[model samples]
Target: MELSNINWMLGAACLLAGIGLGVLGYHLMNAGARNAQMLRQRLAERDRQLAELRDGVGEHFERLGSLAAALNKEVGEATSRLAVEAPHRPDLAAATATMPEPEEAATTSDDVAAPRDYADGNRGTLSEDFGLKQADGDAPQPPRY
Candidate 1:
């Protein structure tokens, strides 16, 4: 009878241990599942944000392309108008009509020398007239209030 009681006590202890282990295992599995769900949700949100950013960038590039094309068309129209109107100016008409073709003009040295005098003369006069000073020079005294 003593041996039987000892065996029964050991069996009860083992059963209690097994039940505690099972509860612990169940709680661990539940926590892991919750963590996995949270990770999946985060990944989904990130993917959505990336998709939105990609779409926005695509739209921005498309708008830039459209604006560039519009600018090009306007520039072309303006160039045509200038070409048409340039000959109508009385002062410019004679000069334009008498001007040699580009191929003929390229063979002459006159075009290259035309602006030499203009560029050489009064190069520094504008800055002097404007009273502009270089930063390396002595600082001008501040005006008294």
Candidate 2:
């Protein structure tokens, strides 16, 4: 090729390449902006949902507190009424009365007998009785499948 024609071709190729790179860069930047906008919208929606949930929980706690207070008031009134009426009823008198002490014979049963010790029941091999050791000549063989 001629030297001037070669130079012209190189310059045209560089120009084409520069234009392609610029277009690609612009599209990529616009795509990033679109993605950022979408993420911001999702974040705003999540924030709104969280605020609603917080309000709902606050209302629930208020209701629970009121219910507990009412229950306490009702229980106090019932307890006072029971205390006033208990002495007038005959059936409740036995249950409400103080207990009597037992005779001396009942408390001496543990002292009369000594506690007996037993061997542990879970330590031996499966083939032998749990509390007994296996004989040296009589080891159990594994079963065939």
In model 2, where is the ten-residue run with the lowest total lDDT? 119-128
Worst 10 residues of 1 by lDDT: 116-125
lDDT tens readout by residue for model 2, 9-55? 99999999999999999999999999999999999999999999999
Q: Write model 1 residue lDDT over 1-145, tens digit each, in one string.
A: 6999999999999999999999999999999999999999999999999999999999999999999999999999999999888865369777989976787666776656554323334555455534454578677789999
* lDDT score, candidate 1: 0.84
Q: Candidate 1 — which residues are off by over 4 angstroms?
A: 1-20, 87-145
Instruction: State in Å the error of residue 45, model 2.
Output: 0.9
Cα lDDT of all candidates, in order?
A: 0.84, 0.85
**What lDDT score is found at residue 60 in candidate 1?**
100
What is the Cα-based TM-score of model 1?
A: 0.48
